[model samples]
Target: MDVIARAGRGMTRGQEFRTVVDGAWSADPAHRMRWEMSLAFVAASEAISLPVQAGLDIGDRTPMTAMLEAHFGCRFDTTSVDLDTEPLNVATRYPVVTAFEVIEHLYNPLHLLLQIRAALDPAPSSRLFLSTPARKPGFLQSPDHFHEMPRRSLEALLSRSGFEVVRCAEFGIRSPLFCLRGVRPLLRCIFEKIRIYELAARR
Candidate 1:
């Protein structure tokens, strides 16, 4: 399957394979329930998104970051560093928005998450937003991905790192076959239709 096609299935199914061969449909409801509570809290509060410090262009040119900025009317400061490099926080840089998309590409997700947490300015209301493929199969499909993160494992990692998940949901929608002529919005519409499993965490 192609990248998007593979990503579509991997995001939803990859993690369940390791935990239960039966299927994700049976296992994800409980996971989603936990995420819902986390998300509701974020929706009620005003929190900033974290910026991408490194690895630009991980997925589709940072659509999620731009969307959040537009929607929330918040500006973000970005830093660039590899997973192995330590994050630099200059006096001029203070980020409330730290967004990492397609981060399954990183070698150590837990370490990266911790690094991100440490880099942020300590505010009780500070929040972080993260999304990764639900499992290893999704990681394998992407040339850059180093690991696939299952829902439960990811939740544990976030919690251990002092984050409380607020919302989580599977994102993606199957596109309809055949496009009408002169409709430029078809792809955009399809993408907008894509459901994302989103999570909001706060310390």
Candidate 2:
């Protein structure tokens, strides 16, 4: 793990905590969770328009980068931060950041959010788009999830991190497999049981 100074703050720290939440990018592409997240990625791509965007997830295995580049002509960066460091010390800033189903895997999600907020472009139009599991009674969240979040709690966290909740809602994903190609199905899935949050920096 590398130790480096955080951007702007100038505090030296070790590398981010290491973990592999979703490693099987190729072994089983038909998994329901993958499809659901893919739908979320598509929805986020369509809803947010930025010339450059960054993905903070661990691995760049999916076609999300390609899709965004092809559709929006956006430059995408999968490397801006060291994933082994705590609270995400970003090396660059961007107009938009996408962390799909990532916060739930963090032990200090709030800290990460704050860092992301700091790394944002700081314009009202700059945004952070993220998704995580919605906490529900008797719901079986993934084992990798460190903390499942309810909608209100998530909104509160965003507010505390200096972000305004533009849109935060729970959606259900029934047919995660077939919904990846079309927008309507993805939109329907977003309105179902899955949790998707689109937030804007307060600026």
- In terms of TM-score, the best-performing candidate is 2
lDDT of 1 by residue, 1-203 (tens): 12221121112224322121133432444334323433343344444443322221112223333444444455544433444334434343233444434355554556556666665556554556565545533312435445555667777777887677655555432234322333653543233221123333453
| lDDT at residue 20 of model 1 (Cα atoms) | 18
- Whole-model lDDT, candidate 1? 0.42
lDDT of each: 0.42, 0.56
Over 1-203, each residue of candidate 2 has an lDDT whose tens digit, in order, gives 13332221112243243233233532343335544565455565444554445544323334555554555456566543433255455566777776665666556667767877877876566767777667744334455455777777877888888888777655554566656968755654554355676778886
Write down the RMSD of candidate 2 (Cα, Å).
8.2
- What local lDDT does model 2 show for residue 13? 44
Candidate 2 wrongly placed segments (more than 4 Å):
1-23, 26-50, 53-61, 79-89, 176-192
